[model samples]
Target: MRGIPLQKTLWHLGVLWRKSPLALSPEARTGLWKMSAPASTFDIFLSHTWHTPGKWKILSLFFQSGWRFSFLGWFVGASLMLLASTHKLLPLFIPYRSNFDGATISCGAASRCLLGSLLGHGLGLLLSPYAPSACARRPLCFLDVASIHQTDRELMERGIYSIGGFLHVSKELQVLWSAPYLSRLWCIFELAAYRTANPSGRVVLSPLFVECGACICILGAYFAAFLFVFALPLQHFGIYVVYVVGLLPIYVLMHLLRRNILAKHQLFEGLRFFTLAEARCESDFDHDFIHTAIRAWYGSAEAFTAYVQGSLRQELLASKPTTIPLRYLVLLVGVPFGLSLDFLAALIAREAPMEWLLTEFLAGCLGFNLCWFFGSVQIALFLCDRFAAPWRGGLFDYLQTLVLFLIFFGVYFLGSLMASTSNLWHALAVASASLLFAIVTLVCRRAAVGS
Candidate 1:
């Protein structure tokens, strides 16, 4: 079997991140294939589509492989937040003119200052403790574009015919699913062949939309941070205006969530009604070859189709729904949590009074930033489940979007109110309530999964 190192595969794919496999020159692809190590078995068989953007495949792989990229993301985000807090980078250009109770308050600058110092402390804590490394051995993956021949027709045909051999040897089949994956003949053939060859091997479905949803959550968090840093200075105009401005990010998030929901619905529906006859291939010769192979292996095309419709459908559906996994959630929550560190840093930097520190740390950082943002993501996940149902119509989707916006706005409004208050008890109350809501939503989701 032709196998490429995980690191090299990522490098080559990164080079072609914006382009499809067709964009690679035949000579370059042939060279990549030749450079691959010859192995009797592969650790992973990567099944993907050429039609989808390459970046999606890369992101899916990173998400599936491990937490290396996630940790890197947190490190980079925390570093940036620290810099912004210290005014070493990303200075708020907006003039601060808000004055309350005989004191001029530069909320924007103060927020940044606090964010930077808190990140600094966090970095210290992260480094000061000695923790064992959690890295795992990287798997050798058989990627079609690199493993199969691209230039010579004879070699290409041989490679295509030998795909079953590779799949048989692979311990795991990783399907990087996109919208077009189910309708493609070759994708279905690969999936069916792998299952037939290794009945006990793992089939890991890493849908592209789930990654997109996680990305949307992270982006929304950053957008919220932007509004907090810039809009807080506008409190002189009225807090309600800041709330209105906050709607922009929430609206964008809802729009993306709608797309994610549609994709997820299509995915499950496709699995339910998969038909080999309807699957398309670019070449009739390739189609005939696959059909012949299937008949030879399973005695008839109908039997193979039954296998796909019965066993494969159940297996794929048995995996988790479109809800973002816990790891991705951690990555998502880290965004605002990292930003909230600024509040702590600011408190320490100015040597503020104990009551001020308590208010900002408890109310601003934990309650408003961490707990409120966590609740917002839970709401998004819940809305995703609601809209994904087939019974929902376009009109209802629009109404739900509106409802989601209002719900997010209300949460933000309440968080802002609590964070602005000087009472530590109010901060504790808001934090407790939001945390409880997040936990309850999570529990209900788990129960739904169980049932």
Candidate 2:
């Protein structure tokens, strides 16, 4: 709404009020800064694990002091967190550990009561280089730093420069590592927002924040409401813990692997007929024979029909072959991650007292799965538009993503009716993941056509 001069003035005003943030009083600052957009991905990310820096010194001290548990804590915690943030949802499992009381948890390992805490700790470590410790102390301020790089030097030179000092040397790692860390940071921020704000808080937390909070709240309420809810007749506490802890790593690894690695690639090249190759195919067969060979490759009636139909459409214009970008991975991973986190937060909170019947717990789990599936669809849509075409990938396509929802419901309906509800929506969600892959294919193919 404001012109350059006005925006410049806002920046200047922000500079004048930078260090002594609480001085302006919260309301007036929020009111003035409302002119800016909400926190960007970067903002959320930094907040997620900003605590590591402060803890970093303490953690480093542990190592220096040669504490056995501290070393084990950092090592195991970092590895697990690296694994967990990628995949949020986990399957149920039972484990046996010599030290642990009963069956231990594992997505595939022993239960970690310290899983989230250690995750938070490890995340804090991974994030320590890019995220300043001071920021953790004043997390809400990230909303103001949404996209700021304006005072980087000043922040490091004068402000509590714990992480920033390291960042001075390795800007790339500092910048690159920020993504996943930022997300975790945002989760913490949401957690803080939930704690700090009133029940009637008008700020309106995003759906995940709202869902997670509500789920956590409802979960506790359910234990109080139903006598049988937490009065487990056939206890599977160990199995339950394993299931939950196992989930956290799956969440983390999925993001790291999918977003950081698998989802990114360079463009693929080469198309026949469209561009003449200097070297031609060395087949010495006749044109008719070659035609026969080509037909046989796509011999299926459906394949032939699709090929014919696709060939005729002017809309199917070819461009340069492109690779899926990290952004797509972010969508593929981030969307599902947020949704599943919401679901898990709900599920855990619900089962806290451990009294619910197995049947009800199962149903609750399934329903929450459905919720995550929907939320992920939103993320998938965002990725589609973000990677391929911004306009085409809008609310409409995202809304249309219900094809996936229906697909899962169809599977779940068929599955849960049988002996086990385990594979019920699982297949559909997997299929949807494939569908997302296909969308990526369509996008990259489109990019290829354009190029």
lDDT of 2 by residue, 1-451 (tens): 1101111222322342234233555554444444434331121212223322322222222222222232334445534543453243433232211111232222222123224323433343334323334433212223222223223445322422222221222111101111122223223223222322322222211111111222222222222212221222225786466545543443333222222221112111111122111212224342234334334545643443344234412211231112222322221222222222322333343332233223223333333233333333334323432343222444544333333334433543343343122342443454444445446545654554355
lDDT for residue 371 in candidate 2, whole number 0-100: 31
Worst 10 residues of 1 by lDDT: 124-133
Over the stretch 187-280, how does candidate 1's per-residue lDDT look in tens digits?
9889878978988899988788887787677667666776766665555667668867786666868767766768877887788777778888
lDDT of 2: 0.30
| lDDT: worst 10-residue window of model 2 | 267-276
Model 1 compared with the native: what TM-score?
0.83
User: Which sections of candidate 2 miss by over 4 Å?
Assistant: 1-126, 129-379, 382-404, 407-451
Quick one: best TM-score, which candidate? 1
Candidates' C-alpha lDDT = 0.68, 0.30
